[model samples]
Target: MEKRLSHVDDNNTPAMVNVSTKQTTLRTAKARSIIAVNDEILALIENGDIQSKKGPVFHTAIIAGTMGAKKAGDLIPLCHPIGMESCDISIEVIESKIVIYCTCSVTAKTGIEMEALTGASVAALTIYDMCKALSHNIVIEETRLISKTGGKKDYYHE
Candidate 1:
């Protein structure tokens, strides 16, 4: 069966989903972003974070990720405006890659997968922004939803 798009109306116009009738539940979502860098910059990040003019690299990205989760509705059209209960971001270095995880929680009618994704995406971009001065070889390889709980169903990757 072909899956219907929740954001599309019968008239084929983009529309926000109505979750007013749905019961509020504890919703949580986790997302991940991976960035690959060359050996030169990897060595610079050996201590785990880089100090840039904007501030500490991972520190600034964490703040940006939280902000992104809270403002996902403003950035993505057709998304419901939700007040996130909590948002957490963690950055880790594995070999020559930087791994970022953003988890968002909300007590609302709708799931917060979009918010989590937005957080991860923004965090990755922030890292790229801070590290770009060192090397242009930085690559944001992937951004994906790792898991989501609550709503009608729960999904977990791996």
Candidate 2:
């Protein structure tokens, strides 16, 4: 069968999905965001973080990512507000790039893919914000869902 939009009604109006009838299950999603930086800035970063006047870059981004995951419904319309059981953010630097990973877990009637995606995006943005003064050459690239489990089905990229 062809896939249909879940956030629309027969009248074609945007609507929130009713997941009350669905069984509550363990749902988890992982997302990734990549930040490309120039060699100069990469040299400034020691370990996995860069310490700026504002604060430690990666550490602050991690906190922001967790908050973003929990408040995903507030940022996106039609999303069901949910209390996530876990929200994890990790950052690693390889060569001239930083990779951010966000994983969100919840036991709910709906999937947590949005939350994971939001977390990774927010974290990438935060990194850019902290380091923009050093150079504008930084690029936030490839915000994508890496994996998702539970709900009606599970998904994994490659």
Candidate 3:
């Protein structure tokens, strides 16, 4: 199996990967998150009553996701700061859960997988925060990278 951690040598000293020698490429990554809501919240979403108290939930999440993507490095330790060219977030209701997908792209030496993952995670958190008043049973679960392109190898969901 591959090593579980990077940014460390055999001695386990903290270090940042030297990507300066790597080629600048068009890097992109997609990540997903699921936020489960209660029946009352789901009904509000279906009836479009979610917008009565606040603006569109999905729209707010999209904006928050984009902002989160840009600040991933700040929020997470050991993450390399990167400037992204584009960040897009999509949210949909699947059954009783809200599914969030975030895609981030950049022309840089390093990939934007962390940015994509952070975007999706924060978006899910935002949804929970917005609906917590209705019910505290909300749960944010299963955040993962769906696909990544760039670096030495590319990965995609089968």
Candidate 4:
């Protein structure tokens, strides 16, 4: 097995990977986040009663997710700054939980998995922020990369 270390030095100092020699490819990644909310909040969403003092919940989250994907490198240390070609965010309410999916693509030397993950996570946080007044029992259950393609190796969730 090969160890994928971020740093080439034994000290493991923080540094960005040099991808100048790597081939540029069309890379895409999809990630998802599940946020579990209380029944009261779910009821509000189902009833379409999102007229809180904070404004619409789902719409705002979608916008925030897109912005977050573009700024992923600024938020995450050691992540290569990437200019995403496109970012799409979608949210679906399932029973008492909300599912957020963010897909990002770029033609570059690096993959966009971090951008996708960041987008979903920020969107989940935005949802929590918007709905916290209704209930504080919200839980960001999980955030994971669903798939990645066009890199040296392709990855998919099993």
Candidate 5:
């Protein structure tokens, strides 16, 4: 069968996909966000996290990312509300960029890709918000799904 956008109706109006009949299964997804920082921002990093006037940048981002993942359904109109079984956020500095990875898992009818993506994006934003005082030049380069498994198909990129 030809694939169509799940979030659209016959009239081409936006709609939420109905997952009611779909069988429940374990679903998981991972997403990545990369933020480029200048040397001034990098200098603030110590002991696995950056300390700003607000708090530990990496630690706060982790918490915020998990919350974002849980709230994805409320934030995105088409997304189905999912009670996530687990959410993990990891942050690392490589070269001049801050790399964030968000992994989410759930037992549900739909995949957990959106939650992971939202988590990573929010984590990157939290980092920017915390470090903005030091430099506005901080760049959030990209947020993309790294992998997803469940439902009809599985996907992975590098």
Candidate 6:
């Protein structure tokens, strides 16, 4: 069989994938995002988190990232709305880069890769938003899926 875009119909109209026929299983996905900050922002980092005027940077990002994962279906067109089991966001500072990881799990007919990706992306954005006042040079370097499981196949990034 040939592989094609799952969210497009034979008539070339965009549509949500019909996951009702798919088997319900425990699906999980992990995604990563990297944010690069300048020395000014790095200087303010006291511990694992940064204190911003908006509040604790990492703490606010954790809440926002979790919300983003739960709301990915609403944000992205043609994505299935899933009742996710859990969403975890972890952040760490390494050198001048801040690394974020979001892991999402769901027991449903479809996988949760989008949720994981959205979570990581939002967390990275949140970090940028919180720290932009110090310097406009902050950059969200990359956002990508690290791994996914419990679908037609599984994947892991190198």
Q: Which stretches of candidate 4 lie over 4 Å from their true place?
A: 8-11, 46-49
Among the numbered candidates, top lDDT falls to 5
Error of 5 at 7 (Å): 0.3
Per-residue lDDT of candidate 3, residues 1-158 (tens digit): 68646788678988778788999999999999998888988888744326636677777778888899999989878788998999989888888888999999999999999999999998888787778888899989789999999888999987
Candidate 4's C-alpha lDDT?
0.91
Clashing residue pairs in candidate 6 (N, C-alpha, C atoms within 3 angstroms): none
Model 2 CA deviation exceeding 4 Å by range: none
Ordered by lDDT, highest first, the candidates read 5, 6, 2, 1, 4, 3
Which residue pairs collide in model 1, if any?
Answer: none
Worst 10 residues of 1 by lDDT: 39-48
Reference-based lDDT, residue 11, model 1: 100
Locate the minimum summed-lDDT window of 10 residues in model 6.
45-54
Q: Write candidate 1's Cα lDDT for 13-106 as tens digits.
A: 9999888899899999999999998888777664678877878999999999888888999999988999899999999998888999999999
Q: Name every residue pair that clashes in candidate 4.
A: none
Report backbone clashes per prediction: 0, 0, 0, 0, 0, 0
Q: Once superposed on the true structure, which residue ranges of model 3 sit more than 4 Å away at CA?
A: 1-4, 46-49
Better structure of 4 and 5 per lDDT:
5
Q: Whole-model lDDT, candidate 3?
A: 0.87
**Tens digit per residue, CA lDDT, model 4, 57-148:** 88889999999999999998878998899999999988778999999999999999999999999999999999998889999999999999
Off by over 4 Å in 5: none
lDDT of 5 by residue, 11-103 (tens): 999999888899899999999999999999999889999988899999999999999999999999999999999999999999999999999
Displacement of residue 83 (Cα, Å) in model 2 is 0.9
TM-scores vs. true structure, each candidate: 0.95, 0.97, 0.91, 0.93, 0.98, 0.98
Q: Relative to the true structure, how large is the alpha-carbon lDDT of every model?
A: 0.91, 0.94, 0.87, 0.91, 0.96, 0.94
Stretches of model 6 off by over 4 angstroms after superposition:
none
For model 6, residues 1-158, the per-residue Cα lDDT tens digits are 99899999999999998887899999999999999999999899887788877899999999999999999999999889999999999999989999999999999999999999999999989989999889999989899999999998999999
